[model samples]
Target chain A: MKNASSFCLLLVSLITPSLWPIIGHADGVFAFSPEQAIHVRTLAASCAACHGTQGNAMVKEGGNTSEENNPVLAGRTREDLLSKLLGFRDGTRKATIMHQHSRGLSLEEIDLLATHFSMQIRVIRPPLSPQKLEAEHG
Target chain B: MAEPFNRRAFIKAIGATGLVLASRPSLAMASKPPMGRVVIVGGGYAGATAAKYLRLWSLGAIEVVLVEANRQFVSCPMSNLVLGGSKSINDLTFGYEALQANHGVIFRHDTVTAIDAAAKHITMLGGTLSYDRLIVAPGVDFNYQEWPMLASLDAQKQVPHAWKAGWQTVNLRQQLETMADGGVFVMNVPKAPYRCPPGPYERACQVASYFKQHKAKSKVIVLDANAEIISKKGLFAKVFNETYAGIIDYRPDNAISHINLATKTVSTEFDSVKADVLNFIPPQRAGKIAQEAGLTEKDYPWCDVNFLTYESKLVPDVYVLGDSVAAGLPKSAHMATNQAKVCASAIVQLMSGSLPDVAPVFANTCYSFINDHAAMHVANVYRYDAGKKMMVSAEGGGVSISPNEKEAGYAHAWANNIWADTLS
Candidate 1:
């Protein structure tokens, strides 16, 4: 029975290392890595669902800009995005959903997402190859 | 997966790889890598994205198979527009062709029956297949016990939910088309945390939009079980007041205690509504496959997972994404696709014997097209909260306070982009 209890304890520990509090600062344990930065970019691309791939929603294809209400996040520096976010979180800057979204974000995370989006270039589509086009039409 | 590379070093190392990804997405997938088999059940947004990215990030080093019951994917995102007559069912339908051809993902058109997590295999109609890892993104299943009206197929056809975006969507549209002018079209909104909190409101808007154009004399009623509009509260309220005031009759906090299809009446505690058409979107939980696996523990409707990796807490090496995850975030396609990316990355890294990033960042967008012309959205970023072990909201989050026609253009592009990202 004692041996069985020890085995059960070992099984629980193996399955749920995540149940611990010190998430980072350990080996064989989950924490931030370089792959996370890449994964986070895929996360940021979700922004393109609304803000466009460049974070500028008003700007349309072929340099046409719409008279839209939301502000553009493209070409803005990391500091700019961070400062705005801080203001929203602190109630310094007025916003509707921004305040709510910025509520629990640590300063480090705000900087990371802002810095990533700040580096994004505007939209550019590669021309379709003639060979592929012919294969399609034929 | 090599040595313990910290966050900064890993980010810097992946930069050159990112260039290769941009230049040639499928170039890396040309050669198979060391990672073994990964089989994913369900081909909704989450499962599909997981399969595609697992191959992409693994650089074709792994064999990834996606088992989906349906050959074609019907998106719930713009499905409401089908009722409004702005878009068609085919417009939202996507096949696995590109995902198979371009991303090198294997597609199996089969429904998964059971998961033997301990044995690391799944049983289905064809045969049982073993995998190094299993991803379950089966979305949601409706709980139809409260309303006997939805118990029978005939009753379900008359009072369709139209939430899943296929035949039910067609059924709702046909009902609207056949209802007598000046007849009442009533839709009941399930309580909060149902798939797409904004969906019923969006459906109400779509029905009202159709009424304004096709059946101007008809009355559209929205009986919301929640005390208020659950998502995009201000924007939906504004549109209803300005655009759909006369057409849409919205009532809040009226939970339907009984739905009698025999008499075509829906009732709450004391009040009842008789309608020409009834749309009942019942309360929902995780898909049955997860339940059959015994993964839905402690009376939770969804499977509990380490949000960082989306691996089921109860079942090892078995991951759950999409609406099946019991995370606090809105049950949405946007969240599903993002969660899939995180899951895919974690699986690859873990296969290489590396731990996943604990403090991961993610984002979600809740977009609502008020009508054919005007649209609005609420978007937010999220980070892993170690204390709570959940992905909590982060910075760079906001919504459209003053939505317009131009934003409507953005909304359509978004649908196209999300579909391409998930499928292609």
Candidate 2:
């Protein structure tokens, strides 16, 4: 019985590696459990419209962004992200959209967002063309 | 303590690290099996968002099937642009391809016939599907009894509400385009608790902007049932007074008693106003499915739901969100999407035999354009009010100081991002 069980376990391990792509790793990017991936992605997604997708922005906030605006959030220290969000939420920092967006998030959600965004790899984005900008400009 | 949850506890419950590490699979990840089946009805902002996030949080362990009557979801948020000629029907239309392809959310292109709340199953055109948890985000439906003349399915087209988007939007655009110069384009705003509280005013602004540029002599007359503007009151009022003074005529407390379709006139209790193109938006209730399921028992025209989890107070294991639920949150795309996340989180936690976060918080930003080039917005944060049993405006949260031209771009960004967030 012990030998049969060992054989069964070996067979399962062998098959799981093969089925990884088909079942488990199908969403190849997010290997973590759905809940964690979602928790990070969804909260981070709320910032995407203005902050750029996943917190990498070519332009800054307040409809007028210059070099003076902060750098990309990806790969920043967890403490930096948390402080900025808390600043926006508590009115310590001046902002256009972030203040309104960050007002109600609990400290836990803030921590999750900070950890998620800070851990991501920073992405450098190309500038938008005038025509493309026109199309994007509502 | 309502300090909410610690990071370690949340990590332990999801077992996300353990599963990916492929260690502690026997004891840790097994604590909360990721095998709950959730079925959501409707594929609008609320439903689509719930479908996607449910899968995201469950790590695809929970099977989520979205049953939508329409193949393509039309957004009512930016659909108002169609009437003023800034956008087309195609721009407002979205397909379910991404929700299926990217998120692994299953879709059923069919309508729901009935819901068996007790059995936790729903009947569709083809067959019934049972669910461990059923989420109904059916949105809102027009109450046409106020204007009986536009009651029938055929009669409704002649004076389209264009409230639900799609063909009505096209029809309304056609009406506005074909009307003669110096024509009167009249639209009525219903009472509160309707989808998109400031939508009628925004539509009025869009039409006025178009008339100012294209049909110089034409004008838009707004007849509002409510005593005053319900949302973004100061901004909307200011825009009407300064930007669209002559082009848009807004009258409050002018409720519609009946409509004479033949003469193209609307009659109120005290007066009658004639129009060239009538866009009569009717009062709305929870979508027909919710009404049929007896979810709106208290005459509130919406299902009562707990703000934290969005579970139906009337039915066990059946949750409702968006405009269909009597949550104090405004019925806008932003609010609906936020509510959907809260609901999805709670469901996953419940499925895992863990408690949902006690003190939930989210924000809603509503952006409405005053013209093609200019826009305004109101951004407010909301917290779960355990005392009131609903979500209310958090302290120090309110509308923007004023409307601005720069906000137009931000508004467009909002539309672009929100639609992408919900659909893609």
Task: Report the error of model 1 at residue B90, Å.
Answer: 1.3
DockQ of each: 0.12, 0.09
Considering the true interface contacts (CA pairs under 8 Å between chains A and B), give the fraction that model 1 also has. 0.20
- In model 2, the number of clashes is 3
Candidate 2 per-residue lDDT, tens place, A38-93, comes to 45454565554344445665442443443213246777765467667767776677
User: For model 2, what TM-score does chain A reach?
Assistant: 0.57
Local accuracy of candidate 1 as per-residue lDDT tens digits, B1-424: 1112133422332343445466765564544334688889999989998988887778766678899988778889998998988987767776777777666677787788888898888888877778899999999988886766586767778888888888788778888889888989988888878899888998898889888888899988888889999888888888888888898888889888887787779888868889898888989999889888977986778899988889999999999999988988898888898889889988988987777766677667677887788888887777787998888876557679766776676566567556666776
TM-score of chain A of each: 0.53, 0.57
| Per-residue lDDT of candidate 1, residues A1-138 (tens digit) | 434433433343345333233223322222334754655556565554445434644333453243322445676765467667666766777755567666645544555556566655544332111111111110
C-alpha lDDT score of every prediction, in listed order? 0.74, 0.74
In model 2, pairs of residues that clash are A34-B56, A34-B59, A35-B57
Score residue B43 of candidate 1 by CA lDDT.
94
